[model samples]
Target: MRVMTKSALRLLAVPLAVLGLLFGTAAPASAHAALVGSDPAQGSVVKTAPAQVRLTFSEGVLLSRDAIRVLGPDGERAETGDANDAGRGNTTAAVALRPGLGNGTYTVAWKAVSADSHPVAGAFTFSIGAPSKTSVALPTQEVGGGAVGTLYDIARYAAYLGFALLIGAAFFIGVCWPDGARTRPMRRLVATGWATMVAATILLLMLRAPYANGGTLGDAFDLGGVRDVLDTRPGAALLSRLLLLAAGAVFIAVLFGSWAKREDPVERQDLAWGLAIGGTVVSVGLAATWAMAEHASVGIQASVAMPVDIVHLLAMAVWLGGLTALLAALWGGHRVERATVRRFSRIAFGAVVTLVVTGVYQSWRQLGSWDALVSTGYGQLLLVKVGLVILLVELAWLSRRWTARLGETAVRGRAAAVAQPVAAGRKGAGGGGGDASERAGQLARQEAALAKERARKERDGDAERTGLRKSVLAEVAVAVVVLAVTTLLTGTQPGRAAEEGAAQQASAPVSEVPEPLDVRIPFDTGGTDGKGEAEVTMDPGGIAENELHLLVTAPDGRAFDVPEVQISFTLKSKKIGPIPVTLGKVDTGHWSAANVQIPVPGEWTIAVTVRTSDIDQVTRTKVVKIGS
Candidate 1:
């Protein structure tokens, strides 16, 4: 017992630890940043599509030399102007758009890199005025049937299924059948699960590079590209899950032969079961974590939302997976004894109940809108799942009713109430003059009828139960499809589809970029020679201020001090006034760090506004870059 416990604790840590690693550390798929919102809202009609396309990032983005192609309805390139950084600000970019284009279906395809190096690529379509072709082609469901989106959904669903099955199988093997006959098969199952999961994982990991670095598939696999997903919580959690899987494999071996060999069958069973349970626990936890990491949980907000949904999702997986497995086991082993069938049927019922209740609660929490059920991809997929579950509920009811009747026949010792009265009446009729032998023969006939009836009912019940169970499996299979779709939907986008379309239609305000306008303002130097030369260097962390030395030579070579020197800068628009601050007295000149900030990037005029008894003059200077 002690040995098994030690083994279970020491070695069983494999799956848990791996789970911890993978879930806490697994990286997000390569080359994809979840779409937060779009510029041209979905289903919006605009008089003009903007010349420049802008996409906002969840984090600050690097200025990448990406090819952005905007195609018009006739499949001609619509954007005649060049794309450049409109200005410098966090998580925002602007494209120079072309004007005077005719009305048509316009598609804007963009590729960009976030400051963290994760690359993102996607396309959105908006129409100019009323489209020549009123029926627009949505990105989804063309003749090709949702090419990219569907493919993504398929891959995600595959990962979700493999992860769930692997975890579930580990749970049963480690916990329920520790010393059972299927040890070899169980080991094989665990091996298959791990391999399936890791291979899928490697594929996902490979995506990060392309999403971050951009270019071809090879680019995504590069170090910088992979680093993008790995550095984030989503990517880290994924990696951790993979590591846990490898460790679990090793721990599975220790649980049986070396660590558990000396123990009795029952003791070994307990040990194995505990280990399986432990593995399952980890897998389930991580599975929930997988979705949690993706769902916008940042900082303290994550603490509440992730844990609640994780528990709810894990509970749903268990109930659904367990029932699916039970159905497969019972359906295949067709002529199951009535009693065993009854026991399993009861279990399936409870599982279904839990699945439905928890599923509803989780859905309500994740999906915030009623309209979303039909509007969003997530909503539609959820509708499909709900429909499938109702079918499952129906099949479960049929199985329950059949199994209950079968249980009646399996009751021991005596006939049931329905048959008891009839049997008693027959015995009473044969009572007074009948010999013991005659009575015994009559009883034998009665017993045979009861036995035959039990046999008939059971056969019928088994067939009925088997059919119902298979239907349940079908429902499960449908659910898997739904789940896969769901996983994909979680990654695609949510909210603001319409808003994006509208913005696209508005199209850069339909105003031409104005020709540069020059304006002049005079500086009152007050006949004094200019004073100081100052330099300051700015970095992300801190600023290094330099001293300015200026020697003023008056016409008569008489040195004079200019008190209260102040410098202020005005933006190009000058809609905002000059930002003025004092320059303190230094060894050479005056300086101050008290007021400092470069609000926006562009050309700005510096004004050296000086104060002296002889003169109050503002010296206007040319534009300068603050932290170029």
Candidate 2:
């Protein structure tokens, strides 16, 4: 007994340690679909205006007719029509551009619904002929920002939880434990799951429009917005999920109806079989809705990927859902039967195996390589998820041990139950041969002894029930965290997207040299030699950290001397620091600063302050592009 207790404690320690590691290492990374690439790529200058603008994403995207906008140098809409899917799989969106807009820069602002139902928005610029200054602004926030996204994420998590509970509990009642149906609480749990799922689906549908368009909270219920959402893939998916849930409810009602009647075993057995088979079919179809609207439907060989993903979701539902069912219905009340626990244990084991197999396939497809696992943000999150699951598996092992103990105790209990009655009967009979009054007294004593044994058995059963409940609760707690991670992961970019982006960068024309920052700033002071040129040089400049060099030339084109030169950089978009850097006088006419870091990706303001004399200086600001 002590050895088993120690083993259980050791098992408990694994998930606790894993939870510590999970929370310690996991961070909230940027979520939303990744931009794979765009035509007339970021910061590219083309000699001719393209007919249409196209953007590709790492996952499938449902493009709204008005999702894409192209603005020309005149700050007017240059796009000719509404955006459309450029390909069949929902990965690309394109909008026509007005031709011959006379050689300037154009900005493309787009909004899209990713396969996982998250809204993403972004903007980039491309130039036709020489680049010209324009007033088109980039999107400040990704769609589904602030409270909307939080609420949406919560809804997603809830939906998953409800699905698991409803499906797992129904499955348990129909197949593993027919007695579970007799309990009102267990039946109510199934109803709660279905209701939760239905509520979440409706919530997601209502929020879909405002989320995708980056509109205000009030926009969630706009009649037009909701109608527009119904036209999209995500909305369709949610509707399908609701319909499936409704059908499932009917099946559950009938299946449990049989148990409620407490009919003959032969009739109940047939009903149970029908429920199991029908339930499996409905669940698979429901799982397909998720696959159709998520990462599973994107990427390579989606035909194969989709099925694997469905299985993965089902496996999760069975394992975690069953754990929740056990905690809620079985151990929470009367002591569960040994056979029920053993059946669930077997089901959990099978589910775990399925999880492993499907998870491996997903990792390979999403991560692509080992380097991605360590380097990419998505990969790092995957590691966190894997860690949590490993711990959950350990917790499962502990619960199985407790189950075995419960089985042994139950067997011992039955043995005592049978043995005590037999012994009492023999004692009464033996006394009967001696005297009639003695026999009556012996029988009375025997009845009291049997009552005492029954009480003892009940006490033992309670103890075992308490032990089992504790194990299950601990397991459920860990499983909830795992589900949270899975939810977060759904909205995050895959490592495959990151790798493709890197590959695109690598394949860019090496022959194309980086443009240098050659700004000639005119400065003036109180002195007669005030009017002069401060020529600044930044080698290999666009977006990279590079050295800064300054050379001062007088109005007469002679070498002009400056007392001190300093530079300040500010990234207004990100509200980054106005980092100040002082230049060292290198020679008669020059000053330089080496290895200056830009820090973030975007346009940065570089201001140069040159002092010609005491209290005599001029500061010049110029915007420069920084690389990602």
**Candidate No. with top lDDT:** 2
Model 2 weakest lDDT span, ten residues long: 23-32
Writing each residue's lDDT as its tens digit, candidate 2 over 87-122 gives: 957778889887667776677788887776667777
Instruction: Estimate candidate 2's alpha-carbon lDDT, on a 0 to 1 scale.
Output: 0.75
lDDT of each: 0.50, 0.75
- Candidate 1 local lDDT, 544-615, one digit each (tens): 122222232234444445655556667776454487654555543334443245555456666655554455
Tell me how many residue pairs clash in candidate 2: 2
TM-score of every model? 0.49, 0.69
